[model samples]
Target: MDAAARARLIRALAGTVIAHADELTGLDQAIGDGDHGLNMKRGFETVLAEADTLAAQPLPAMLAGIGKTLVMRVGGASGPLYGTLFLTLGKTLPEESGMADAAPALEAAVAAVKARGKSDAGQKTMLDVLVPVLEELKAGGEGLPARLAATAHAAAEATVPMRAVRGRASFLGERSVGHMDPGARSSALMVEAVVTWLEEQA
Candidate 1:
């Protein structure tokens, strides 16, 4: 994606989180700290506010700022986990860039989330959506954004039937079986937002 597309994608993420804030809060209430949406909204609000400054910055720089903001502002496990994902990406990404290669960034992001979250595909975490979606992106090559949207949507839907194995949901044991993971749900939304923005860019 180009500089303009990058900016728009980030803004769309921020807006998507804000738009679904209540639903996110509700989802979190089912299996987590109940603040997934709230904290994310706050972090992305900070992201949106800094958009002007970040507009001309490299992708890694923009991600680094977001990571720092989340680490500082958000609370509980989300602050550290999500913070680490973005922070790791910021540290790992290429420097002196032109337009970012979207697929690689998404793949890196999925890896960061998996590493930080410390859970696998069957755990019904964000990995269910992220891992498969990244795989599809890598496999499809072209039409990646559309595939990502389908994958995320499928993963989010799949979460409803699986038991939670990570985070606070693990505490619930069998009770966690029915409810959706807040993080996974929101992660799916994030993927969808990126796909939407990518389509618009196209």
Candidate 2:
């Protein structure tokens, strides 16, 4: 991607998180510490502030830089978990990547997130959305971007019915079932943002 495209992608990612800060916080309030939104917003704001510098780098380096920024700026468990996701993608993806490179890189990233969080799918965590989105990417065919957005939304919604078994929500046990996981919702929003941007480019 060109520097302009990189800048646009960063804006979309950061803007999405910032825009939904209130919604994220609301979700967290139901079963978590209620800071997911603020933390994500803060981290992404920093990312936005550094967009020019980040856009100047190779794609892998840009991603790694964003991950590092998030790890340093975002608060709570989200920092390390989301940081691991991006950092792993940065490590696995080529500087210039194609669709063929994305699935495997994302797979590695998801694995890293799982290891970092000690969680997996069906746990009312971000993994609930990420794993399904990864599967959709692996499936790869027509309308992939739209399919990914749909998959992410559905996966996030699916988390509402699941009892939390990890993270702060785990403390609520069965009480967590009625609420969507904040991390899952935020993850879905980021997926939607990136997918939308990709569709626009196409």
Candidate 3:
């Protein structure tokens, strides 16, 4: 990515999260501490504030820096899980990566997230959205950005019917059903934002 694209991607991701903070908070209020939105917002706001410096770094280094920033700024389980995702991606991806390289990097990142959260796809967490999105990326067909955005949104919605098996929502047991997972929703939002930006660039 060029400097402009890097800056744009950072804005897309962070802006989406910050823009939907209230929605995420509403989702969290159902089964969690109702702070997911606030935490994510704060973290992304910091990211936005540091966008110039982050965009100036090499791709892998930028990702690693973002992960470290998230780990330091964001609170709750999301901080570590999201941090691990980016950190692992930074470790796995080459500085100049192609679409082919992205699948393996994302796969590794997903694994790291699972290990960090001690959870998996069916757990009504961010993994629900991420895992399916990874599958879509691996499939690698035409209109991939649109497909990925669709898959991400659908996967997040799929979490609505599932009872939470991890995180604070798990405490609600059956009551967690019929509500969207805050993490999953947030993940989907970010994915959509990135893909949308990619589509625009293309």
**Alpha carbon lDDT of each predicted model:** 0.79, 0.95, 0.93
- Model 3 weakest 10-residue run by lDDT: 57-66
Ranking by lDDT: 2, 3, 1
Superposed model 2: Cα runs more than 4 Å off: none
> Which regions of candidate 1 are displaced past 4 Å?
1-3, 96-104
> Candidate 1, residues 1-202: lDDT per residue as tens digits?
4577668867998899889989989988888888888988888888888776776778788778778888887777777777877787677677654324545776777677777777778797877877887778778667777878988888888888788788888898888888877777887898899789768876
Off by over 4 Å in 3: none
Order the candidates by TM-score, highest first: 2, 3, 1
The per-residue C-alpha lDDT of model 1 at residue 96 equals 56
Local accuracy of candidate 3 as per-residue lDDT tens digits, 40-131: 99999999999989999887888888899899999999999899998898899998977789899999999999998999999999999999
RMSD of 3: 0.6
Q: After the best TM-score superposition of candidate 1, give how far the Cα of residue 48 lies from its true spot, in angstroms.
A: 1.0
- Tens-digit per-residue lDDT, 1-202, candidate 2: 7999989999999999999999999999999999999999999999999999999998889999999999999999999999999899899999888889999999999999999999999889999999999999999999899999999999999998899999999999899989999999999999999998898788
C-alpha lDDT of candidate 3 relative to the true structure: 0.93
TM-score quality measure for candidate 1: 0.89
